[model samples]
Target: LKAGNMVGPRVYSTGTILYGADGDFKAVINSLDDARSSLRRLKAVGAFSVKSYNQPRREQRQQIIEAARELQMEVVPEGGSNYFNNMTMILDGHTGIEHNPPVWPVYKDVKALWNATRVGYTPTLIVSYGTQFGENYWYDRTEVWKNDHLLSFTPPSVIDSRSRRRTTAEYGDYGHIDIAKSVKYIADGGTKINLGSHGQLQGLGAHWELWMLAQGGMTPMQALRCATMNGAAYLGMDKEIGSLETGKLADMVVLNENPLDDIRNSESIKYVMVNGRMYDTDSMNEIGNREKPRLRFWWQMTRGGDMINLPVNNTETHLFGVQEGD
Candidate 1:
C-alpha cells in the first residue's frame, strides 16, 4: 500500500509479537544474541518496528530494546499491566508503552516521572486492563450495529453479533474512565498520550478512544491532539503526516462538524484524503483527483449477502471469554 500497489490506508506493522516468555507466538530471547537475531529476522521480513511482548525478566526486555536500538528500529513494548515493568521500559528508553498501566488513580510522583521522560503512552482503553473495557460503554449506549459507515466496511455479521446484545455497566464502574483520568494528568504534565483502539472496532473505535479521553476531563482539543499529532509523533511520522504543514503529506479528514466544539463531532467526517486523493466517507469511493468505486467485497457477492455465519470454535470462545449467547 505504501508503494501504491493497492488502495488503502498507509500501514506500518510490527509483523509479529516477540516473546520473552513461553507462549503461542514464540520469539523467545534467552540471550542478547537471541534478541538481536530475532529482531533482524523481523526487520528482514519488512517489519517497521517490533512488539516486545511480556519478556519475563528485566534483562530479557532490555536485551530486546538494546537489539532494537542497534537495528535502528522502534521497540513498542507491551505494558502487561505491570507497574514495575512499565516504569523500567520508560527508563530503558522504549519507543513507547503499548497499553495503560494496570494501577489506577496514578499519583503525582508517577505522573511527574513519566512527564519528565520522552517515552510515549498509547493507552488502548478499548481493551484496557484493571477495569471494564471502554468499548462496552459505547456498545451499551449506542446503536453500533446501525452505524452505516462502520457497517459499510465491516462485516455486518461481526458488528451485529458484538453490538446488538451488549454488555451493560455502571458509568462509575467503567475502569477506563479512571485510566483516562490518569492519562489526562500525565498529559497535562507534558507526557504525550496517543490514541490506540486495540482493534475492538475499525473506524468507530478511534472515535471512542477520543471521547474516552475527554471523559477524563481533557478538553475536546486536547483529546483531538492525542488522536492526531501525538499519534504521528509517537510513530516518528510527525514531520511527514501529523498536521497540515508545508511539505507534509496530504492526509487529512474533512469533517462536517468541528471536533473542537464537541469531541463526539470528530466522527462527522464528510471526506477523507490520502496522498492527495479524496474519498467519500460514506461509500469510500474515490471522488476528487480520480473517480473510482470501491470493489465489492467477497461477502457482498456471496449468496448470504452480508449475513454470512462463521462458526465459532470452543477454543476461540474460551480464549475471548465469550458467553454462549454472545
Candidate 2:
C-alpha cells in the first residue's frame, strides 16, 4: 500500500491481516499448499495476524496454526455457536478467540483447557445479549439507552427509535448466566480478557460490555484491565497504548466518574485527549447531529455507532489492514 493512498480524507496504512474462510466447517484448508498459500498471501500483504473465520478441522486447524506460527503471524480463531468446537480450538493453541464460544457454566473440563492454553478471550457480550430495540427488547431498561451523554453523541434518528416497536426473533438468553459465569471463571483464572462488542452501539457498546463483565462478577479494576491492558497485550501493542505509562501515547478518556466504582460510570465522559490535544466532548456530539442518519430510525437503533467521531490525541487511527512484506 502507498503511504498517501487515501480512502476519503484518511490515509490508509498497514495493520491487521484477516484470512477469510469459505464456510463454517473443517477441511477448509484442504492441503499444505492451500495453507501455505494463505500464509504467503498474508506475508505479501504485511499482515501480522490471521483469523480463521469458521475454524477448520483439528488437524487442518493445526496446519494453519503452524504455518502462521512459522512466520510469526498471530492466529485468532472464530468460535460461532458451538462450545465444544471452541474447546478444540483452544486445545490447538490459537493466540486468541474471536467471539465468546458457547462456554456457559465453564465446567472443569473447560477450565482445564483454558488453564492449558491461557489464550486471550474477547467475549463480545453486546451482540450476544444487548437489547434489540427493533425486536422490542430491553424497553423497560431505560437505563441502557436513556442517558443524555449517550443521546448527545448518538444520532437523533437513533434516539427517536428507542421507543419504536418491531418484531424479530432475538437470541435466547438461556446461555447468558453461564456466559457471565464463564467470564468470571476465565478472568479470575488470570487469563487475559478483552471486550468485544460485535457491533452493538459504538462507544456505548463497549461500556455495555464492561458492564456485563462487571455483572459477571469481575471487579471494576479487573474489567478495566481486560478492556485496556489486556486488549493492548493481545495485539502486541501494550508498550504503545494500554496504560498511563510515561512513554506511551496519550490516548485516553477523561471520565467524570471513577470507573473503578461503577463500570457504567464510564459513560460520564467529560473530554477526550488524543495526540496531546483536547476536544470538547459536546462538540464531538454536535458533529453527529450534522451527519445524515445512515439507516432507518429503528434499524439504526438496533446497531452500534460505528460512525461516531470521537477523536483522541489527534493521532490518525490506524487501519487494521495487511501491509506489504519487508
Candidate 3:
C-alpha cells in the first residue's frame, strides 16, 4: 500500500511477532546476544518497530528494549494483563505497552509512575482483560450485520456469524468501561492513551474504542486525540503524520459532524485523504489528485452463479483469520 500498488490505509507491521517463550513465532531471545541478534534480523527485514511479547524475565525483556534502542527501533511490549510487568516495562524504557494492565481503578501510585515517563498506553478496550469485551456491547445494541457501510467491504458470512448472535452482558458486567475509566485517569496525568481496537472489526471497531474512551470520562475532543494525534506520537510519527501541520503528510478524515459535540460523530466520515489524494468515503473512489474508481473485491467477481470460494484455512486471506468451517 505504501508503494501505491494497493488502495488502502497505510500499513506498518512487525511482520511476525517476537515471542520469548516456547510458542509459535518465537524469536529465541534466551540471552542478551539472542535479543540483539533477533532484533537485528527483524530490523533488516523492514520492521521499524518490534513487539517484545511476553518475555518471561524482566532482564530478557530489558535486553530486547536495549537492543531496540541500539537499532533505533521502537519496542512495543505486550502487556499480557500483568501489572508488575507493565510497570517495569514503562520504567525500563519501552516505547509503549500494548494492552491494559488488567487492574481497574488504579490509584495515584500507578498514575504517578506512568506520568513520570513518556511510555504510551494502548488499552485496546474492545478486548479489555478480566471483563466482558466492549465489542459485545455494540453487537447487543446495534444490528452490525445490517450496516451498509460494513457490508460494502466485508463478507456477509463473517459479519453475520459474529454480529447476528450477540453476547448480551449486564451493563455492569462490561469490564471495558472500568478499564476505560482508568485509562482516562492516567491520560489526565499526561500519559499518552492510544486507540487500539484489537482488530475486533474492520474500521468500525476503532470508533467503538474512541466511544469507550469517552465513556471513561474523557471529553469528546480528548477521546478524538487518543484516536489520532496520540497514536501518531506513540508510533514516533508525530512530526510527519499526527496533526494537520504545514509540511506534514496530508492524511486525514473529513468528518461530516464536529466530534467535539458528540464523540460518536467521529465516525461520520465524508471523505478520506491520503498523501494528498482524496477519496469518497462511501465508495472509496478517488475524487482528488486523480480520477479513478475503486477496484472490485474478490467477492464481487461471480464464479458461474456463485461467489468465489474464499480460502477457509488461509490465515492471510482476510483481515481476520478464517475459521475451519468458514
The candidate maximizing TM-score is 3
The sequence of per-residue lDDT tens digits that candidate 3 reaches over residues 1-326 is 97889988877787677887787677777687998998888888899898888888999998888888888999998899888999899899898899999888899999999999999999999998878788998898889887777776777778889998889978888888999999999999999999999888989999999999998999998998888899998888899987999999988899999999988888789999988999987778899668897765665555444444443222122343345883
lDDT of 3: 0.85
**lDDT, candidate 2, residue 228?**
84
Per-residue CA lDDT of model 1 for 246-272, tens digit only, reads 999999899999989888999999999
How does candidate 3 fare on TM-score?
0.91
In candidate 2, which residue ranges exceed 4 Å CA deviation? Answer: 1-28, 129-140, 143-146, 166-175, 285-326
Q: Quote the lDDT for 166 in model 1.
A: 97
TM-score order of candidates, top first: 3, 1, 2
Model 1 regions lying over 4 Å from their true place = 3-5, 304-326
Superposed on all Cα atoms, the candidates' RMSDs to the truth, in angstroms, are: 6.5, 11.1, 5.6
Across 1-326, the per-residue lDDT of candidate 2 in tens digits comes to 13423211111222333334553432347666677777777679777777776644666777888888788877777776667777878888888877777545667767767876768888776555322321132333444444555554555456446534433343453344357667789777667888766655656667777777876788889888988899889888889877899999766778889988777788788866554445456445222224322222222232353432433222122322355898
Candidate 1, residue 177: Cα displacement in angstroms equals 0.8
Which regions of candidate 3 are displaced past 4 Å? 304-326
Q: What lDDT score is found at residue 59 in candidate 2?
A: 68
| Per-model TM-score versus the true fold | 0.90, 0.73, 0.91
Better-scoring candidate (TM-score), 1 or 2 = 1
Better of 1 and 2 by lDDT: 1
**lDDT against the true structure, each candidate:** 0.85, 0.63, 0.85
Predicted structure 1: lDDT: 0.85
